[model samples]
Target: MPESTRERGRVEASRGGSVRLEDVAVRFRTKKKDVTALRDVSLDVAEGEFVAIVGPSGCGKSTLLKLVAGLLKPSSGAVRLRGEPVTGPRHDIGYVFQRAALLEWRSARRNILLQAEMRRMPADRARARTAELIAMTGLTGFEDAYPHELSGGMQQRVALCRALLHEPPVLLMDEPFGALDALTREQLNVELNRIWRETRTTVLLVTHSIAEAAYLADRIVVMTDRPGTVAEVIDVGLPDERDYAVTMARPEFARATARIRDLLGAASAAD
Candidate 1:
C-alpha cells in the first residue's frame, strides 16, 4: 500500500495531468472460451505524472494500456482522460510499443513526421515539430537514417520522437525499452526520464521490470496474475529531481523496490 494518501498527494502534485479508470474490465470471447484480461481495474494518474504499471506476463498490463489508448474497449466500466470517456483512439494520446514500429523504408525524420501527417498538421509546423523531437532525442545527425540502419536503442528513440512529435497531452507506452539489452535499456531509461521531465507530458508506462518501474515512475501500480486487477499501488518516495545513479542509491528506492517485489511475489503465489 502507499504509505499514506498524503504521500500519494505529493507524488500526484509533481506530475501535472490526471488519468482515471473507473472499474474498468475487459473480456474477450473466442470460438472455444472466454478470456478475461482485466478485472475491476481502477487507477488515477495525475496530470503530467509518470506512472508505471508492473505485473506478471499475460496479466493485462498491456491490456490496461490499450484500454487507456482506446485501442480496446472494456466489457464494463469506463476509462476517462481529464473527464471524458475514451471511446476510441484520441488525438490527444500518443502511443509507443515494445517494438519501435518504425517503417524500414522511412528515414528517422520521416518517421517522426508520420504522426503529423496522420493528424493533418500544417506542413511547416510539422517540419518544425519533427526537427524539435529529433533534436530532443539526440537524433539530429541521423535524421535520414532508416530503421534498419539504426541500433535497437536508436530505433526506439525514433519511436519516442514520433510519439512526442504531435505534442500529445498523454503518452501510453508498453514496454518501450523491453527489447533492448540491459545496458541499452538503462541508458534509455535515463533518456526517457529526461524527456518526460522536459516535456511534462502525462505518461502511463507498462513494464515487467521492478527496477525500471522504481527508476521511472512517480507511482507504481502492481497487478495480479491473469485476469489482472490492481494488487497494490506504491508511492515511490524518491525526490522528483532524479538522475539514474543518484536516485537508485537512495534508501527510499530500495524500500519501494522491496515492497513492489513482495507484492509481485504474493500475486504470483496467488496464481
Candidate 2:
C-alpha cells in the first residue's frame, strides 16, 4: 500500500517554530453526509515568522488559521502551540478579520481598550500600551476619533491596534485589508509589515492577493482546492525592512509571486 497522505505531510517543529500541525484534517457532518474541509495538512511555522497562506476561494485557508487560534478542532491529528495541543479558544492570540468591526459608540482609544478591559489589565498599563500602539501605528492624532469619523484604512488601523493591545504572541489576520481600495490596501500592507517587524509576533495571514502575500510574508504557503492540502511553500527572499517600490522591483519578488501564481493555476486546473 502507498504511504498515507497524512504520513507524507506530517512535519515536526524541529526549529522550535511554536506552531505545528501534524497530519491534520477537518470534517463537518451534516445530516446528509460528512464533508471534509481539510486533509493531511501539516505545517510548521517558526517563532516570529511572518507566513502568508494563499489559495483559491474555499480552500480552507481561513480554517487553518482558526485551528491555530484554537477556535476549531481537528477531526484527526493535532495542532500544537509551544508543543502543547490546542484544545480550546486561545486567549493568547489576536485575530483581525477583513472588516474592522469597531463598535459604533467607541472612540478609537476606547475601542482598543476593549481588549484590555476584557483581560482586566490595569487601567494605567492598558492606557500606556494603547498610547504606544497608537503612536506606532500612526494613529496618534486620531485616538479620539470615532470609527464613522475615520477612513477605511484608519478604521482598520484601529482594529489592528485593538488586536495588539493585549500583546499576544501570535497574530492571525484574515484579509484585514481586503475591503480597502488598492492604494489604501497597499499602504496598509506596508504598515502591517512594519508592525510585524516591531512586534516580532508570529503572523499567519490569509489573503487572496498574490502580490500582498509575496510582499508581506517570509514564506508563502500555497494550497489546493477544497479538502485543501499544502501544494508548496515558497520562500519570499526579501529583507525584513522592505521599501514598497524597491522590494516590488526586485527579481526575487517577481519570482516568488510568479511561482505562487503558477502553483495556484495548476491547483485550480487540477481541480
Best by TM-score: 1
The 10-residue segment with the lowest total lDDT in model 1? 8-17
Per-residue alpha-carbon lDDT of candidate 2 for residues 4-119, written as tens digits (9 for 90 to 100): 11222223235546688999999989999988889999888876788899999998988999999999999999998867789999988899999999999999999999999999
Clashes of each: 6, 0
Q: Write the per-residue lDDT of candidate 1 for residues 1-271, one digit (tens) a residue.
A: 5333434333453322367898988999999999999998988888778889999999999988888888888899988876688899777888999999998889999988899888899999999888888888889899998889999999999999889988888999999999999999999898889898888888999997899999998889999998999999998866556888888899989998999889889988866
The lDDT values for all models are 0.86, 0.89
Q: How far is candidate 1 from the true structure (C-alpha RMSD, Å)?
A: 2.4
Candidate no. 1 TM-score: 0.94
Candidate 2 root-mean-square deviation in Å: 4.9
Worst 10 residues of 2 by lDDT: 1-10
Q: Which candidate's lDDT is highest?
A: 2
